[model samples]
Target: MLDQTIKVELSTTKKQKPNADQLQFGKIFTDHMFIMDYTEGKGWHDPRIVPYQPITLDPSSVVFHYGQTVFEGLKAYVTKEGKVQLFRPEKNMERLNQSNDRMVIPKIDEQFALKALKQLVSIDKDWIPTAEGTSLYIRPFIIATQPFLGVAPSSQYKFMIIMSPVGAYYKEGLNPVKILVENEYVRTVKGGTGTAKTGGNYAASLKAQEISSQKGYSQVLWLDGIEHKYVEEVGSMNIFFKIDGKVVTPELSGSILPGITRDSIIQLLKYWNIPVEERKISIEEIYEAYDKGLLEEAFGTGTAAVISPVGELLWKDRKIVLNNGETGPLSKKLYDTLTGIQYGTVEDPFGWIVTVE
Candidate 1:
């Protein structure tokens, strides 16, 4: 277990908070952040909450060279009754350790991490945006800090938690988005870091993302790395398709991320008695479903966007439109229910909420 005593050092100066109406994703940060250090022999120590500031690192830091890092994202929401809450934060911590294990980083105590997070959020509770579709974005990450150019695991590391107040992740909001299917580059393959929320996986996606953006697409839909035929996931979110009347998402086949939002939606559907399936879904199969008029809706689920409806998908020379290029009813309901539970307006049947009192 991590040391329970966390040293708190309030910031001596504060920056002006951005207006709620003008808030943008990750562009602004709160006044404070939480940090902890890990050493080779001594393990993690010196947990502290201090003013948000940059730290100097050696040019030969392992992170800069080998890219050994992991990160997780979640949000703090202000309820209508003015209560602060988090949705299934323990799951994020669990995934963080999973990523850490994959990257050979030391494990962190999930319970202690949650406690530290709650304290950090409680201290900066004022930064939680109450505007519609707005909340405090929480970023928890770990990086290899050992100043070495070696290819092996670093002897030192830093874990941090930073908060940002932001609006919607996509300018389209709940509106549908256009996706470009990439056949040139793949994100990751099974038995790779694709399942882990690490920087390398996202870094590998930038090329496809850049090209897709140039083509006027909102995001890139990646296919399996090996055959490049099976559907994997979107750049920043997990993809799902509602065919006919049943909901289907790509199965976690070791290459796809296990999204917290994705799991929540699956459970939500089952709770409501809505048919849902998780299995290997191929792009060609999706196109076939669209041809048969079974592809009724498509969407992506992640921490940033919560739920992003897909209106159009471009693959090779074919372009298929879904739900007449508008938000589908199922998409909107999932969004409303998920967001409602997140913001404390809906009854949380799964007990996923963790209050910051």
Candidate 2:
């Protein structure tokens, strides 16, 4: 219905090019945007692509104080043949709806939302970067807009999608990241909104992330809130430890965000006949494996970094370096296979990429 029905608002901008190498992440915006509004009675409506401009929200808006916001991060890439493709966007829409269902926000049709996004991309296809590892980063978010001070979910909301041209996660090359062991500052706990892609979770994490950054750590590896023994995740990304020739990651404990990249990696591992396990993994176990030289490699997976190799883990004063701060064999193999599939360089055995044009 959306594909043939609506005429997109084309608010073009004078193409002012930036130094591709100097592009800071999320610092610039494209010309146009995709927007849709939702009210109490009228569900999602007014879906359109407008000029990128400041959106007005009252200071007392619910999202300002209550933080009832949810978002999804994904990317669209134009292939070497100038064909635009999205990387399994249905997964993002499903996750976005799951976020809506949990937040009590009005559920809109996912197919329609996708159609709107594809049309927006088609209009702004020229903004997509043609450089290596660059992409059109898509951010779809919903925020509570009602002006009530009460504690309940707002009756009004806005669902909007924006695009930004982004350089690769590792512009300095594929370098290993140093993760700090955060004994405190638990990311999400049991019976909490950890599974939801809400803003509060991220807002709660910024302080810890800032502290870690100041202390020369690239990210933080969160521990289980109750015992602080089990490994949870790293920053916003999930962790995978290659132990004993098998892949082991933390099981979904109701506190961990089920990262789309993490799920995809597990599937690809299994498809390649590599041993993979999803279960409880403790800090002690990982440390022991590393000490015994059995820990082949450790990396965090997500949409942002895609795959970040961990060179050293900083637990207070202890520094556990993984073989001289270089990417491991398994890490390279996984990165190559996944990125190859994404960039249309490898055989997409599972048919994950969706062509946009």
Candidate 3:
């Protein structure tokens, strides 16, 4: 429906696709990619699909200097019936626009972007992996292209969609991970670019993540930037805790990224009539609950790892283990139900699945 004029050029020499069993995350790309350009006066134009290759940009591109970039990630699953489907892709597009607004980039038409995604996926549909715990990872991003040296918004930009066949995020697959509570380095602050899905945030987290990795931790549990007391997120994922028969997650207070998976799990919890609350949850409170024997379970949710159970939290030499460092019942159930709906094995009561064909 987007002008019906997108020019697509299939790749003549297709690259050898990776086997599903040996697939890694974001390493193997499909044969083709979707691209669109934008100018200051003339909005977004020249929608096209071409062979996947390197892009040429000037050395003075704003994206390289000022870091004006925003991206979104979603996956396309292959059902048992050999059908391709996207999970709440519109939500990703909506979030991308929100990021664009914050990054000073031009907003793209969501419907058009979705159509482009479907067309691109259809062209490389054979690249979709059907093996267990494997799906096609879709990355849609926008970058400032104006080759200007001044510190201002770019007048030119490029929007692109690329696909990769990826296996599970963790090699262990749905197992609990050890997280180090980060009280020193902060991921983001209030009135900052915390909610936006931009590159600078991830760039800023690399140091803490590297340190935590050296310390034998999977990820860093970031506390609030102001006082470094309240919980914000765990690595790149939003976190949740089960305490005394209730589910609690950090409320969206303009600093945390409103995760789609986080929202879905909250909805699922409420539908099951479980006591769920979205409010400020401090790390000390979680420690207090653990001290009082009320801490039931802990997990993190995101696009990559659907639900990653937190087995241990190490804060200042104090270690709090959840569920005996094993995956909890609630964590397992959520992962199973969400993945079942994604793979078309369970009935989609909430109408969250969208078929490609």
Candidate 4:
């Protein structure tokens, strides 16, 4: 059920207006935050909008030991009307519930979360950046709190929503990035917690990403565990390939995450009459198509980055260049269209825009 006792206490940095340019991707925090706690029998309570501060926890907390936790990411924007808006927060709420189901985190009312978050944002609206490609990043996470030595899920949990100001994914501009195809390590496997937005998945991919970065690549193109031929994803984002004039992406196979940006791209492309296909994309097909000049485009989609074009992919000693080392026409079209809708320039016929005011 939705927690009704809404507490309020503004942060000490309650300024009239924060310098928008000071945001350096989560370096600055907002004046308020949302927090709630849950226990096995008591459920979720103490829904509050309080000052942003550090959270104290027991050293033996289950989350500290076994790492039974889950989290979500979403953003809030400031429209030209000087009012705040969120892009389909209900979807994030549902995704959080799905994560709870997978990790055994207790479920709280989504409406209550929406209410509490809105209150915090309303109180700290000045933190929202007005610059292009800038936003107020919202992160909601739940961690096990009960101190237990057993290897089981904790009975107590803490859910929190912290906000930070972020700038464009690429500070200079939207430049195409090179990706490394990592065949050595698998990010997630079938029947694993790949579909959920839990920390372990990201942790497993960190080593691979670090290796790729150390070798001069921006991200890694992961493959399925069993065959290692099917393309899975790119870092934390979903992958897409435009082959033979048809856009193809790996279908969600329980090991793949269904990103909001990926879904939005599919919908927008279909609306524009673009042939977007969702199927199992094989690495062999991509490499062969690159040789045949059929692979027109490739990109990664996620919340942090709306669309990151893949200019080159290094698989072992062989390098595959996508469409001659630049962003494809279709990739740019989708990026502009999606961003246009988000910034309220074009029509939002799908009813995806949810105004915060």
Clashes of 2: 0
- Model 4, 268: alpha-carbon shift in Å? 1.0
Q: What is candidate 1's lDDT per residue for 260-289, written digit by digit as tens?
A: 999999999999999999998999999999
> What is the alpha-carbon lDDT of model 2 when measured against the actual structure?
0.86
What tens digits encode model 2's per-residue C-alpha lDDT throughout 222-315? 9988999999999999999998899999999899998999999999999989999999999989888988988888999999878999999987
What TM-score would every model get versus the actual structure?
A: 0.98, 0.96, 0.98, 0.96
In order, the Cα lDDT scores of the candidates are 0.94, 0.86, 0.94, 0.86
| Candidate 3 per-residue C-alpha lDDT over 213-256 given as tens digits, one digit per residue, 9 for 90 to 100 | 99999999999999989999999999999999999999999999
Off-target runs (Cα >4 Å) in candidate 1 are 170-173
Task: Please give the lDDT score for candidate 1.
Answer: 0.94
Error of 2 at 143 (Å): 0.8
lDDT tens digits, residues 1-357, model 4?
Answer: 564768897666674444655567666788788898998888898788888889999899999888798888888888777768787788888889898899988886988888777877788778888888788999988999998879988999999999998887766656788999999999989899999989899889989999999999989999999898999999899999988888899999989988889999998888878898889888989999998988899999988888999999998899988878888998888787777777777678999887775
Clashing pairs in 2: none
| Candidate 2 deviant stretches above 4 angstroms | 1-4
Better of 1 and 2 by TM-score: 1
RMSD of 3: 1.0
